[model samples]
Structure formats: C-alpha cells, structure tokens
Target: MKRIALTVSAILLLFATAEPKQKKAQPKKQEATSVQQEAMKVLMSGFSTDPRFTWKTQQDEAQRICSQYPSMEAMPAQAIQKVIQLSQADLRYPQWGIFWGDWREGKKIVENPRGGRFASYGFSDSPTDKGGNCYACHLIEKGMPGGTMGPNLYQYGKRWNITKENMNTQEALERVKAVYNIIYNSWSAFPCSSMPRFGHNGALSPEDVMNIVTYLLHPDSPVNK
Candidate 1:
C-alpha cells in the first residue's frame, strides 16, 4: 500500500511540474502563430487598379516594402537605396536643346488644371495638351494659390536656402541635379513623398521643367528678383 501511494504521488508531482511548462509553451506558440498569420494576411491582400491609371514599374517594389510596416510606414534604407539607383539610372533629361521657354506659357501651364483623364481621356488631348500642373502641389506665386500639399514656392529661390560652400558653377549644376532628381524622381529623394514625378510620368516636358527651374533659379526671374 505504501509503495502504491508513493508511485501515485510521484506521478502526480511529475504532472504538476510539467503542466506549467506546457501551459507557458502554448501561449508562446499561439503568439508566434498569430504573428505569422498576420504577416501572411498582409502579404496576401488583394490587388486592384490604383487611381494613377497604371501599375508602374516601381509600384511593386514600393508596395512590397510598404506593406510590411504598420500604417503610415516608411521604407527601409536598403530599399530606398535601390529606388534611388533605379530612379537615377532612368533619369531622362530633356532631349531637345530647349530647357527654357516663355514663362508666360509656363504660367498658363500652371494655371490650367484640367488634364486628368481616365477612360474618357479621348474626349480631349490626353498626351499633348496635358498641363504641367505645377500649382496643384506648389505655391508658385503669391497671385496663384496652391494646395498645401507641397512647400510654398513664393520667393523660394531666395528663401529655400541652397547655401553650400563654394557654390560655383559646377556646384550649382550638381545642386540642380539634386533638386532635379527630386522633381524628376521624388521617390529617390523621399521614399514616401507625396510629390509626383512630373518628368518621369510624362506629365511635363523637360522644357517645361527647365522653364520652371529657370523661373526659380534665374536671377532676373520673379522668384529671385
């Protein structure tokens, strides 16, 4: 009887000791499984047509990185580096010798805001008559109001402060490149920037970009003057 009682007690003690370990392992396993399941859910979300009217080449890369983070997430540095290299490699400057055109024409391009066309793009000039749509994001001039989306461009040339040491012609050109890259490939500058890649998207010509740049950079231009 004593032997039987001892064996029973030993078995009960072994079960009692093992219970907490099993219980602790269960929640950890469940938490791990929950995390994995959540990741899978995000990765497997459905795709649809974006408002931009095209599934661009960089969209997949952007989505892949963006989906991993929580809402309002930024991309990793490695991914951003890849994006910058790709954007710069694909930076297509103005082929025509024309970089500056009439700023009056440029002004019209800024004011006219009626070029976004979906399936009904054929109702008007879809490709050629497209506006440069500057003021949509930028506050280009005091007379013209713009969305608060981008920074104010009023006296931007003077106020924006591009003061680098020894800002000679070469440095100026390099600064143009840096700024142009932002206007050309915003994703390169800021991975999650709301600014549109006007040149890259064929929304504006190089001449148009140049005129805008000239308006900002030229000492005589209103932006500087």
Candidate 2:
C-alpha cells in the first residue's frame, strides 16, 4: 500500500507539471503562426493583383499540401502519395504524342536563361519569351557551367544506354515516356521535388518539354556525345 501511494503521488505530480507546460506551449505556437501570417502579408503587398502575378501568389492543392512540410523527406507517406496522385492527374501531353521533338530546339531552350519572370521596372517577361532555363539547375552538356541543384546530365543518353540501334524498340519508347512525364510533372516521379512542374504550370508547352526530353535522351544530341 505504501509503494502504491508513492507511485500515485508521482503520477499526480507529473500531470500537474506537464499540464502547465502544455498550456504555456500553446500560446507560443499561436504566436509563431501569427508572425508567419504577418510576414506573408507583408511579402504579398509588394506584388500587384494582376492576373499574371495572381497565379504566382496562389497555392494549388498540391502546393498547399507540400507547404505543410519542410522537405520531401519530412512528408508523411499519405501526403507523398497525395502529391504524386495530384501530379499524375494534372499531366498534359503533346497532341502529337510523346515522341522526341527537335533536339536542336531543345538545346536552345535548355541553354537560354530567360523565362517567365516579372518585375515592375520594365523587366517583365513577354508572353512569347518562354524558355526552360534548364542549365540553371542541371549540367546538360560537357564542360558546361551549371548549378549543382539538380543532377548532372552530361552524357545522359549514353548513361541510359539509349542508341539509334534500339531507339524504335518498345522499351526505348517507355523510357522516353518516363522522361517526358518527369519533365512535364516532376512530382509524379518525386513528390514535392525541388524541380518545377514545367508543363503542368504552363511554364513549358508539351512541345517544349518533348524537345528537352529529346535533348537529354537522343543519341545524336551533344548530351550523348
């Protein structure tokens, strides 16, 4: 009876201390949330409510879910699957199909460092000024200076064993399709990836994405050489 009474006393003391600590933690969490909201409001105040800018500020369903976590590794399995499902559902392919486009055009898009950027000081992008700016994230060609944010793509086609001899095979076509899907919507392959959903966001047309895929995977392209 004496030991049982001591154990009960310990439990009661722990509850008394923990309850106050939890109550104190609640206000801190609310304060942090309020600060974050205020910071976002301040950031949004700089941009105009124009239709072009509106899309940049708005979060879609996938983006909303992604924002809840700091990184993909931290995301729960359910959230990761949700993001993948959303990305796959949102994919749009070229009307011509998933065949590779002109690799030359793809090279230009990959190398060009211009795209949909907005600035109030006469630096806004025109509707026709579209580019993939792929070099900013990946090393596409040999000896090219590119950011290390994404994987090195030099000799990507050779690395994949893609060649003219087997280009027409069903396996080759499936590989091409997989690359196309990643370029169009990276989240389908890697949920909450740092890579942008180029085609899904209309940043790149289906034709443009196919061209990039060709540049990365075509045997004759400099990327393979």
| Candidate topping lDDT | 2
By summed lDDT, the worst window of 10 consecutive residues in model 2 runs over: 116-125
lDDT of every predicted structure (CA atoms): 0.56, 0.78
State the lDDT of candidate 2 residue by residue for 1-225, as single tens digits: 786567545533443334334456888656655655554565467668777567776679998777666678888899899999999999888898877689998888777777433322245445346777788888888888888899999988877778999987888888998889998899999888878788887778788889989999999899998
TM-score of each: 0.58, 0.79
Candidate 1 per-residue lDDT over residues 1-225, each given as its tens digit: 787567545533543344334456778656655654554344334323454543442345554443343333455667667766666665766665333345555556556674222222345544346665667778777676787788787765565343334333565556555665676667667665667766666666666665656566544455554
List where candidate 2 sits over 4 angstroms from the true fold.
Answer: 1-37, 116-128
Candidate 1 collision pairs:
none
For candidate 1, the TM-score is 0.58
